[model samples]
Target: MTERESPFIDRTGKSLERPQDQWPPYVIPKEAIDLEIERLADLPAPNNGRRESFIAHPRAKEPGLGLAPGIRVSLSVLKPGERTKSFRHTATEVNFCIQGGGYTEVGGKRIDFKQYDVWNHPSYHVYSHVNDTDELQVRLCYSDAALLEMMGIYIADEDPPSVKEEERDYADEKNRTDPRAKNPFGTFQLTDDGAWLMPYETLINPETVESKAHHWPWEQVKEHLDKLSALGKDYVGRRLYLLYNPMTGRTNGTTPNFFATMTCRPEGIVDRPHRHTSAAMNYYFSGRGQSTVEGEIVEWKAGDLMLSAPGWAIHNHAAKEGTVYELTIQDQPLNIAMESLLWQEDLKLPAAILGSEAGFGTNR
Candidate 1:
């Protein structure tokens, strides 16, 4: 095909077979490929101080590494005996330990960390990290840029204060020393020899967070909600509670992680259709509602689930006469990591529409 006359049209409206390497021929859009290529091309060549050519963000700055809207990712390296000063961020974080070992203090609790360990920091919480190992160390950080932007927050830090002599308290070490101290709050049930998570379970035990600074299992949380509803105290006008499970932020450090939250709206409530940075699945329980998923009017009843992936169009829900409930789970870490969240409001709710594409997740 000639450069101007071709059968295939790319996102940039260029001929597919052009020799200029505008895009990957069969994969991503030519415009997207051009964007990526342009990004890579903008990087300065490696030099003495910057040994790593692909060092995206060398500085630990706030809103540090912006890839796109609503996402921020940063990777850092620490040489032996080199460590970061105590710092805090307005962004919640999920971090993966790529190499070496170190010590981390979150909310005044010190935990020894090693390769493959994951760590999470709640939004705006002060935390510190140190590397005492003899080898180079690295970490991958993911944060929600959109949420932070909405809240008008950023990461800030001060130089590490000189150490002072104070008696360290090992009182919180009871769970570490005792074998019978497992799951004092029934957070992670002993499914086998080790603890396994159930989809609907919640971490009700306050000690779980106190000990590990992380919350897992949502079943117990659900039971807590059940009791509140039984007492007629619905979950409305309450702070949006979250079960933060960072994929690489867990102690065990696994990927493809899951995080979910329960949201309820009393009668005559409507949440406008919007898109987010990640693919999400909403499990509706114990309520009736009308959900418009990507232009399809989906009447959601109890036991129904709705799913929407990135760029899958708009989605929103409206409650019936009584309260409406739903649990939304998403790969938020990835979204926050990649920064591709989108939303729209100010327009009236679209008229009820219908389509044959209405369906729920298979696991629903």
Candidate 2:
């Protein structure tokens, strides 16, 4: 094969061969992502009247990235004073606010939201994003659209009965055990003993049952916020807030398939590389920075979305002069619950990268 031929494609044989290295962990640099999204902002909405909906199709012509099975990450960019016409879909969606603030109407109800607010849209729930802010509004949204599409059940439209409402219920495994019960709110699951999560079926005391919500407002959970700096300089520090579920004391995500997190990389800090099975859909919330994924340097600025797909590469994060705030939605929580979350860190680096052997770890 020529040098320009794709590593993922096997032109030598009649059958296709997908080499792992060819699709090695990669990044959707913020620049290209923002460029596409900004371009979408200026265009007219489809007949559905969604002002601008941006989804990074994982299977692009170039070497694309998809962090996990059954997951699709997208961005919804709305200009000032714009609102989307009501539409519905069969895919469950979790949304993270990246820039500006707005309100959304879900199932005929109004939800006022702001930056860092994590929200959800249940399957078949009629919803619309209403951005009244003077500035452009950007959001990182993810869903199991790929899975639904594969099953031939995915539907998105403003029309009626593309799918039966009952079919939607069967598609949603919110309770996992109860197929008929509708999840009017957020859900939880237990993973480990004395961990943030516990299995739901094993609990003995009904009175002691804990529950987590579908949405977590940044202002409300500010006190529970933990910073990576709290670990001292000994740890390659980054500041992040976890959305926890009060129910199982485990991860608080909109759905069981995935969860979200917010991290703040201090100015000039370079975090070490780590490899894991969970894919992370990353958003550059603020400031400027870069991530080295599979030896590819992906530079990004504020409002950029980068996807670090699972099993692809070792990912290291770094920030420029200013602190970089980031939002990451990943399948880590689900892996932890299944007791199969495998990960490793490469902390030992050259003296030049670590500054000094003594500077590598804190004095703790």
TM-score of each: 0.36, 0.63
Candidate 1 colliding pairs:
71-339, 200-219, 201-218, 201-219, 202-217, 202-218, 202-219, 202-220, 202-221
Candidate 1: 10-residue stretch with minimal lDDT: 20-29
In angstroms, the error of model 1 at 29 is 19
In terms of TM-score, which candidate is strongest? Answer: 2
What would you estimate as the lDDT of candidate 1? 0.47
Cα shift from native, residue 166, model 2 (Å): 9.8
Residue range 1-364, candidate 2, lDDT tens digits: 5576555855674756565552444456667766866887888755555544445444532222223455677667888888877677777677777678988877656677788788777666777888888888877778877656667777887754422352535533465556344344334544555334333443431354422225777666443444455566666534676554444235345455566677767778787676665667677767987778877887777766666544436778778857676667776655556655555554353322111112223211
lDDT score at residue 151, model 1, on the 0-100 scale: 54
Give the TM-score (vs. native) of candidate 2. 0.63
Candidate 2 — what's its lDDT? 0.63
Model 2: pairs clashing at backbone N, Cα or C within 3 Å: 25-312, 67-309, 190-198, 190-199, 196-249, 196-250, 197-250, 210-247, 211-247, 234-362
Off by over 4 Å in 2: 1-34, 57-69, 79-81, 155-157, 160-213, 218-238, 245-252, 336-340, 345-364
Residue-by-residue lDDT tens digits, candidate 1, 1-364: 4576787756796556743211110111224323443453344432311112111222224433332233344445555665455666556655545457777676676767676445566654556666688875565454564345545765444543333423345764664566565544544566677876643223432323322345332345556555655554443333233555443343112122234555555667776555433445444555776766556676655544344332234566678856665555455544333433332332353321111123121110
